[model samples]
Target chain A: MTDPKKTVSVKPDADQALKARNGRNIALALGLVAFVALVFVVTLVRLGANVGNRF
Target chain B: MAKPAVLSPDTPADTVRAARWQDYFQLLKPRVMSLVVFTAATGLVAARTHIHPLLGAVAVLCIAVGAGASGALNMWYDADIDAKMRRTRGRPVPAGLVEGSEAATLGVVLSLLSVLLMGMAINWLAAGLLAFTIVFYAVVYTMWLKRWTAQNIVIGGLAGALPPAIGWAAAAGDAPLNAWLMVLIIFLWTPPHFWALSLYISTDYAKAGVPMLPVVKGAKETRKQILLYSLVFIPVCLAPAATGLGGPLYLAVSALGGLVFLTLAWRVFRSDAGDAADPRVADRALYDVAEAPAAEAAPAVEGKRPPPVGGAKDARNLFAFSILYLFALFAALLAEAMIGIRALELPL
Candidate 1:
């Protein structure tokens, strides 16, 4: 006799849905981080070498 | 083996499938975006202005993103028509990979972000042009011209041609005659390029109720118009060299390539490319963007046409060459500017 709690059955569709959702979330996070890095680099380029030269 | 009790034959679609990030990316029409980026970069480089490299990169990115946004909007709006056509039925929206509302939202958000970023990081002129381009593509071309007129691509080509001018404006804060000359090259190139494609794939356009020249005005007229556009297009290709905008390489490429282009167009003019009442083998070859089973590959694409034995070769060749010709012409210009080759001003 197997314990029911030890062997949980998941719906196939539910499993696929969860996996796809996870993938999208990771991709979105990576995209946001890339956007932030790009903005930072662009800001630095626009500012040139002088940090305190202009207000 | 017993089927799982929880898993039924009829599952709700939302539960069975979820959208991926790549589907969202496909909404942007990356194939078209690539062309926009290339032309915009050429314009930026050809301007001879000293914009910072990072800023220039940002400008090009903004243009590409803006173009992509417009494509998303186009897909969102044209999903129904797209689903009816063989070439476009596999798109994210039409394929049910992504919702139309989601595509619309993505387009709207990206359009705003790209325009605002351009205004903040670059100059307002470039931003203004980018804004206009988005609106023009989404509203004027896609929403209005596409379904209403046989001359749809002729007018819609403006949206595609503006990127070069926008790039020039980004670098120099102004668009001069030379910049618009680049614009002219693409504007003129669009008709023949697309018309050659339409000549062979008129059946698809007809099924979708699209007012393509071949569908509305007949294949012979479409071929004639293609020749007319090519005649005008070739001279404009040569103009860059005479105007001191392009170097000797541009002249050689334009002259040789223009002759070949005209030859192809002439062959299309003489060929019975678009007169088929039935969908030809070329229609399958032309619009086989989807990986459907042998069942859907039947004639007419759900009543879709099958590939014919012969005669679409002329239109197909012209279509292929048009892409190469445009790419090569732009490549020559970019190469000349990158390598510091001097332009040869003709005695005119």
Candidate 2:
């Protein structure tokens, strides 16, 4: 019978891929934060006139 | 629902790591978070005499984080039992991608940070309630009542229902009767909502040695309890109309919803023990799985296994509908509030 230990192969290349994935994730997260901030600023600007009129 | 695990496959070798940030975001139970946010938002909105929108958003965010923290803590503590239960076996913790310690740490840190930030940003009343909610769910519900008693969900439900009141307190610095009315609606809603689920997964819970009502008591007893709780829930649900939170629209929808809910509960209660309730529910022998090893090992051949009663299909349909029932019921309330329809003066 084949060895059970060899059943799962976790290669070093997979680890390298994981590291690359992690880097991309960090960049993407920062980008999303920036986008959200930009949207929040825009919404505030758009709503400012209406809110001032209300006051 | 016993489909494939959401994250992990059977073979550990064939591990799929999602290369996106959204995948990590899914670790937070966003649907439950939304419900928490909605109820809290409704509370804050209702209580807004004159509050800044930014602070209100912060309050909602803190409540959302607190709810997420509780979910993470629950996943952390119940990881073992979750692995055994079919419904929860696919969760991140049980599926083995996320470590239990990591979940616990996230829960604890988030719990503290959310409450502390809320206290500093808002009033102390809301912060105190948030802190109590975290402890109640994580410590009381998760650590204590869950494994020990059939009444766990019934009593521990207050923790889940606190967010609205906490929101109200955040806005007004004091939760009055109207705020408590919101809490009561959810409190009464929990049993029928959860019991309907337990009706399906009684076997899984039994297998996991959780003393859920359906596991400890027979299905007949659980059904009777469901009917009893539902009878009480329907009236409490209408209390919002009296308390100025609901109007004609909410009253009409909630009354109709209550009738349907009662009908479903009655169906479950009336079902004979065997050859009923739907296919997903198999006939289970109600053994006291919570008792000590010595007590549980002794087989009570004398206590004959009751025949399965109730339409499992009916129960399953009711369980599914209960989720929508609560959602629709709350949506009606939101509709009424948004329309600015005031309640009639009820003859109390």
On TM-score, the candidate that comes out on top is 1
Question: Could you tell me the C-alpha RMSD of candidate 1 in Å?
Answer: 6.9
Give the residue spans of candidate 2 off by over 4 A: A1-55, B1-27, B272-310
Q: How would you encode candidate 2's per-residue C-alpha lDDT over A1-55 as one tens digit per residue? A: 9978556556764775577577656866795696467446545754777999997
Query: Lowest-lDDT window of 10 residues in candidate 2 chain B?
Result: B283-292
- Residue B21, candidate 1: Cα error in Å is 0.7
User: What's model 2's TM-score?
Assistant: 0.79
lDDT by residue for model 2 (B127-194), tens: 99999998998899989999999999998999988988998999999999988988988888899878
lDDT of 1 by residue, B141-199 (tens): 99999999998999999999999999999999999999999999999999999988887
In model 2, what is the error at residue A43, expressed in angstroms? 18
Of the true interface contacts, the fraction found in model 1 is: 0.78
Q: What TM-score results for chain B when candidate 1 is compared with the true chain B?
A: 0.89
Identify the runs in model 1 with alpha carbons over 4 angstroms from their true place. Answer: A1-10, A49-55, B1-16, B277-310
